[model samples]
Target chain A: MKSRFKTGIVAAVAAAGLLLSGCGPAATGAGGETLTFMFRGGADEKAAYTKAIGEFEKANDVKVNMIVTTPDDYSTKLKAAIAGKKVPDVFYVDPGSVQAYVKTGVVKNISEFVEGSDSIDLDNIWQYGVDSYRFDGKLMGQGDIYALPKDVGPFSFGYNKTMFDEAGIPLPSADTPYTFDEFVDVAKKLTKDTNADGKLDQWGTGLNVQWNLQPFVWSNGADWLNQDRSKVTVDTPEFAESLQWFADLQNVAKVTPSVGEAQTLDTYQRWMQGQIGFFPVGPWDVSTYEKLPFEWDLIPYPAGSTGKSATWTGTLGIAVSNSSKAPEKAVELAKFLSANETAQQSLVDAGVQIPNLIDMSDQWVKDSTTKPANKQEFLDIVKDYGRGLPANSTYSAEWYDELFKNIQPVLDGKKTAAQYLKEAQPKMQKYLDQANQAAGIG
Target chain B: MSTITRRSTLHRKEQRVALIFVALPVIGFAVFTIFPLLFSVYASFTEWNGISAPVFTGLANFQAMMVDPYFWQAMWNTLFLMIGIPIGLSLSLLLALALNRKMRGTTFFRTVYYVPVISSIAAVAILWQWAFNGDFGLINQALAMIGIDGPNWLANTATVKPAIIIMSVWKGMGYSMLLYLAALQSVPRHLYEAASLDGAGVLQQFRNVTLPMLRPVTFFLVVTSIIGGSQIFIEINIMTPGGGPEFASASIVWYIWQKAFNYLQMGYATSMSLVLGLIVFAVTAIQFRLNRRNQFSID
Candidate 1:
């Protein structure tokens, strides 16, 4: 009995040890270099990466372990990996993380690789995309390039073409944007009770204040931060006017879904069901949007007093881990993913992203057979007027988030935009100050 | 001398065998629980970005947490959520009593009630998110049938917390009800008979016999519910990604998670969690003390 008990305990301990060891990073594949690459996307993206990386793997003679996650869970999973000290060889990053990651030696400096590569012509890639991943000891956007842009996502505006046609409204110009007043007039005309019921079933526009407010604010010559990124500039009159205009689309104009109505089904679902007219479209959304019941096409967002459209372009960078054992092979994979003509073309064809290359995107624009017919609108924004998300340059986004925390009252029309901005500036500034202090960048 | 030696040898063998049985769990406790607990305690006093070596920050994170309005708001929100505990327990006990009766289809009713407890939390939260929709939701549509228009539950700041509370209670009552049912089944028939023989009315009999019988179960439910309720994260994350409108429904654990992972402020988050741990510990201790005098000893 004593011997049996001892064996049982021994087996239990062995089992426990095996379980703990299993949680560690996967063992290196038998006698060959293995590079782990982590990224965020759904099946279509994973499929694209799988095909594209196959070519790179054959050329480089290395095994790549791909860790995939959805956008929502990606950050938490990556943070867990970082905490465990099992950072992937190549991973997705953004401008916001560059400062902290670089300081902690989490990401490696890759300017030498970029300069030395004969295949990757810096001028061919979007300058904005490339600059987003650049960081020196103190500032972002200038200094050594630490990562390569996977894809630059432009937050472009799309209108339901069928809705416009049914309403006997002329199609919006691809090159020119509608003024705020023109956009409102069009929206009012589209907002109607289609079924002849007591309730209004169809509407002109449905915009989330957090996302849609930025284009309006930027076009009106206002911004969330100053040139030096040292101060919060959200309290200006232009910003308030843009905000008030956005709020009035729901409260005063009633062209958008009411808060109560939105709770039943979000604006995205409404747009998908042909109940709403205008919505924001990202490159990543093309495949899904293609299946929508209503026909839609890209348009420049409605302009403010400046008569110019503005929107935020989001990009994910492929960064090399500072602790990577196979840095050269990992960097080769990153380059192939970013700059390889076939890879970029295939990714674009997959409808997951616009071509990251300037020349390739130009070629892509010439093909007018795609659903969006006006694909140039994506490039126009990316090349001409698109700016980084206001929070992208900051060390932390708490400051950016503080601007929206109490913004409901304004959207509900309980508070004026000017009053809201006045109350919001100091709160945002305080968080920004804290973020800067944390980064030790003051 | 030989007999004494043999007995000592047997005793040592028995002790060794018992200790070998206990060894695995003890090691696991020390390695997984005790080690992380001590590390977090130390981390509470340091500035750790989680990627680099930790630097001691002394009381800075503590002082900063004290001034963090959002942290206090989360704490209050967490406390507000605990109000559902007693409400849930009371309703569950009533359910347990009803199910304890000799009724037809009691088993079916029990299974039906326990469905939510078995369902995944993420799936349930998503379903509830849709069900609480203000216009065409299951809840609002039912409310509308009674001549009332419902406000948007999650979109509105006033109703978000109450909406979450209602969801959580609906999700949690089944498990508590099952526990209470078992407790009720164990209550001795002779005790009720004795109370009735003493001329005790139904209410009096319930008060004198049933209530006392349920004391232990009630205590267990309250303590477990509070611990579970205080660490509410999954529901808030699913239903209200940005912590609901105006940060109205952000729980303390959700806030800690956001700070640590999303914002990469591990040091500050650790400090907040340590304080939260202390608060939960003190509350549990106080409950234990309060229950000591009133604890029903079957012996």
Candidate 2:
């Protein structure tokens, strides 16, 4: 009986030990060196990364583990990982999140790596892409580079050629700029009610204020921040005017679908189904739209009062984590992922992103023989007029998010542009001030 | 050793063995639940953003809560959501009484009713979102057929909360009904016969015997549902991105999540959570006190 009891205790202890082991930190790979890379996107993005990582692994003889998460859940998961002290070796960083992440000291400064490397040519890469990751130890967009740009996403419109042809409207030229009034007139002409059911089945365009409204706001020579990024300037007449024009597309002009109508079939789906006349397109949408039955092509954003088509440029950068066990290996992986010509070309071929290399972007645009006859327009916008979101300051995201949140009422026709901005500017300024205080930035 | 001593030794041995059997769970409860609970309570007093080291901030977070309109709005929304509990409980009782009859397809009906309880919240939220959609949803179409114009259920601020409440009741009613059905089955038939002998009708019997007997179950459901309703997160998160059309459907837990995860204000989030926990405790205590007077003991 004593022996049996002892055996039972031993079994229980073993079971408890096994259960506790599962809760412990994750094990390293079987090989000597292992690097974990976390990124955000769906299946196609995952597939592209998998292929690239597979090539990297074969070449270096080091195992690379890829963690893919949806864009919505990426920040939450990344933060949780950091808090748990299990930060990935490398991760995708966005400009809006750079300052916040940098304050935590998790993002490694890749300046030394870049400077020491013989492979990557800093001059050949876009200056804006590199400048976005630079921080002067205190302020962002200045000093040493912390990350390398994986790709640059320039905002433009992808219009359906079939819709234009069916309506007997001529296709827009790559260089020709449409004024605000002309753009609205074209939108009005494109909207139709095919079945005469008293409800329009087709929309001229769709406006997602967060993504597509920047071009309009910027083109009108209005901005959310002042020259030195010290104050909120969105309450100006120019800003209100642009916003009102965008809102009128949906509310007054009734060319775009209402919020309720859009919920049924989102703007993206409507664009895919050839129901929308114009929708914002990024290089990432090229692969998704390849299967579309309609012929679609890119066009520069319509010019506002300034007669200059200014659009926001979004870039995803490859960053090394400070918690990485093998920082050297991780840097190599980051370099391979971001700066390697072959890897960039592979991404370009997949139509996942435009090439980050200045020289290769032209090749990328010309190489795509499919739809988007005006693919060069994307390059033109990026080269001539593309600007990043007003995220040069640490407090930029807080103010930008506040603006996006408050501007919805204006779009819904619950409030006019002037009225909404008047109410929201103070709130935006408050958030900006708080964020600046937190970041110790004057 | 004396016989008493031997008996005491055996008893002590038995106790030790039981303790050994429960040791794993006790350790788990301590490490995972109790420690986190205590840590969060302490964290509420700090000014940590999850990444940086926490700085002691005393009552600043609580003070901020006083002036924070969003926090107050979330609290009001949470309380408003609990309005569904009483309505849900009454509906569940009715369902229980109906389903308690000796029907042919009772098992099938019971399974059908309970299915939503087992369904994942994400799946249910998506399903209900589609059903509540304004333009192409089935609910609006059904209403349209009756010559009534249905409002945008999820989009309109006025209708969003009611839509959430309706979905919550539908999803949760079955579990409450099952509890009621069990309680009803346990009620002695002799008591009903006695009531009938006194010339009581079905409704009178229900009021006099059924309701009185099910008081304990009702108390349990009420307390649990209130606590559950206050912590509503997934449904709101999935159905309404950024707390819906004007923060109309934002609940306390959703607000806490945004403060913690979205803004990285971990300390503020924990403070709000602590406040929510205290509120739940006070509400539960009051419920217990109210029910204490009834003194329904099975023994």
Query: What local lDDT score does residue B287 receive in model 2, on the 0 to 100 scale?
Result: 88
Model 1, span A210-247: residue lDDT tens = 87789999999899999878899999999999999999
Which ranges in model 2 have alpha carbons more than 4 Å from their true place? A1-26, A29-31, A262-265, A341-346, A391-396, B1-23, B297-299
**What is the TM-score, restricted to chain A, for candidate 1?**
0.94
Q: For residues B1-299, write the lDDT of model 1, one tens digit per residue.
A: 99999999888877776676677678778878999999999999998877788899899999999899999999999999999999999999999999999999999999999999999999999999989887668998898899889888888889999999999999999999999999999999988888888899989988888889989989999999999999999999999988889999999999999888878789999999999999999999999999997776767
Q: Report how large a share of the reference interface contacts model 2 reproduces.
A: 0.26
Per-model CA lDDT versus the true structure:
0.89, 0.84
Cα lDDT for residue B29, model 1? 82
Best by lDDT: 1
**Cα TM-score per model:** 0.95, 0.94
User: How accurate locally is residue A117 in candidate 1, as Cα lDDT from 0 to 100?
Assistant: 82
- Candidate 2 per-residue lDDT over residues A1-442, each given as its tens digit: 5965785587579548845864586677777688999999877667667877888888887888888899989989998888888889999988777776787798998899886578678877777788788887566678888888877887778788899999999887778778988888888999999779998888899868777778999999899888656689989999999999998988888889877775524777888888999888888888888889989888888989999888987888889998788899898898888877776776777777778888887666676576577778778766778888886456336566777654667878888998899888998888787677656676
Indicate the DockQ of the complex predicted as candidate 2. 0.44
